[model samples]
Target: MKIVVKIGGKNIDFKNEDYFRVLAQLVKEGIRLALVHGGGPQITKFLEKEGRESQFVEGLRVTPPQDMEITEMVLSGLLNKMLVGIFHRQGIPACGISGRDGFLLEGEKYYPASGDRKVDLGRVGEVKKVNPRLVHVLWEGGFLPVISPIAADREGESLNVNADWAAARLAVALQADKLFLFSDVPGVLRDVEDRDSLIEVLSWAEIEILKEEGKIRGGMIPKIEMAEEALRGGVKEVFIGEGKEMENLPLFLAGGKMRGTKVVL
Candidate 1:
């Protein structure tokens, strides 16, 4: 089965042994998998090292022109290649490429609605289109494609696309069987403070009700929105789980009860 796995950079310490073990297992499973990863934390660290100020409004980072350059440098240039190396070390043939490599992802600038005012986040973008030809070609050639969320426009200008949205779009384009979103958190929690209160399965309608009741807020809001979009766009299933427990990926694919939340249409 074809799967799209998105790994977040927040808790990703590349030296972590468990991370590599889980990644190796996924590749060894012989299931076609495409990895989409975000390196926001790394980018932020780079910016700080350069003595640059970083700002965020409504959880979206405002990428200034210089910051955009650093984002591309860190995400596509550094993190992308690192992941490919990891997979290769596990005996998995992997190819790391950015959205700009083949225009794999096309997008337009995003103006987020922050309360009554609109926030212009510079080169920040939302995925407007995904060309799956490159992905298909790589998969057919027995290579796992690892994508960075940095996209380029028609004018050859690069933009910072949200990794979650990019993965959702790619899942739709590939008509993937499952999309696994690995975040720092375990899953959607019934109460933010309770780790044992993870919501295991949620339907679209139930998600809406949760949002209406103001239970799903903050960073989770966009994640749920993206998952719903993937479901509506043709992905059969979407899983939101903790990256730390990535060993459960195969079990989840096998229809076993996973340690994270499963969102269905």
Candidate 2:
């Protein structure tokens, strides 16, 4: 099965050696994988170090010219290599790439609709196209493709693409069997503070109701929205949950018991 997994860039500990082992095992079982990762926390850290204040609009980072430079450096340079290294350590053949590579992802400047006005988010992009050729070739060659969320505009200008959205678009482009959004939380919760309130399965309509009730807020809002779009775009399924849940992904996809929230049509 082909799957796209987008790792959250928050408090996740990607260095967990066992996690890489789990991923390697899945690849060995003939599951083609594409990984997309975010670096929000890292970007903020670097921007602060350079005396630049990080800003956000509706959970998407506002990337000015200088901020775009820093973002590309951190996401494509630092985090991308780190993940590639992790896979290599597990004896897994992996190719690290940015959305700018081979025009894997093409986007344009984004202006988000906020209230009655369009908020001009500098250098933030909404994906306009996805080229899956490079990734498909790597997957067929038994190599995992790790992608960073840094994309380029038509004019070759760097733009920050939200990692979740990028993964969703890739899933559609690849016609992936499933898409997973790895997060710190277990899954979508009926009550934000209640761990036991996890919703194992949710529908698009239920998600809307939750949004109206203010149960889903902050960063999770856009992630879920992207997942819904992926579902409509032809992806068979989408899962959202903590990274630990991924350890049993192969089994989960095989119809075994797995813990997480599944978003369906």
Candidate 3:
């Protein structure tokens, strides 16, 4: 079975050997996996170092041209290689790449809701299509495909994409068995601030109601939306939660009990 795991680099501590070892175990167990990663914290650090402030609309970054440049540098260049290095240390061969490589992610300009004025989000782009051939090739070659979220526009210009949405699109295109969005939180909580309020499972209708009631906001808004998109696109199952939930990957694929919030149709 194939799985797509999107991990927030901010939450992952590469210094911890145990963390990467868990992932290496996945490969040892014969799971074909693709890792899509986000570098929000690292991007913010780069922007700050350059004396530029970061801005976000809803959960999306407002990437000015300069910001996009920094984003690509941090994501595709820095963080991507870092993750690959971690996997390598764990005895796993990994190919680090960005969405722009091999037409992995094709994108177009994205305009967010901002009334009639149409605010320019710079190089921010949403996934228009995903080609999973490269990912499959790498997986079959005994390598993990570690991907960055920077994609190319129709004109071949680089565009910044939300890694969560990008991973969802990849899962859909690859017909992956499962998609996991790992972060710091345990899962979707009834209250964003209350860790104990984690919701174990949610149907599309319940997710919609929670969204309507303003219970799901900030980063989670995009996560839930992407989970819904993945489910609708025919991915067998979707999970969003802390990285620890990865331990249950085998159980999840085997249709056994697993941790974290499961999104259902």
lDDT of 3 by residue, 1-265 (tens): 7889999866667777676676778888898888999988889998999999988886788899978889999999988999999998888999999999999999998888777777789999999999989998898899999999998998899999999989999999999988999988888999988998989998889998998998988778889999999999999889988877667766666778766898888
Q: Lowest-scoring 10 consecutive residues by lDDT in candidate 1?
A: 11-20
C-alpha TM-scores of all predictions: 0.93, 0.96, 0.95
lDDT of 1 by residue, 190-257 (tens): 88778888999988899989888978876577678899999999898898988876887777677776
Off by over 4 Å in 3: 254-256
* Top-down lDDT ranking: 3, 2, 1
Error of 1 at 109 (Å): 0.4
- lDDT (C-alpha) at residue 20 in model 1: 61
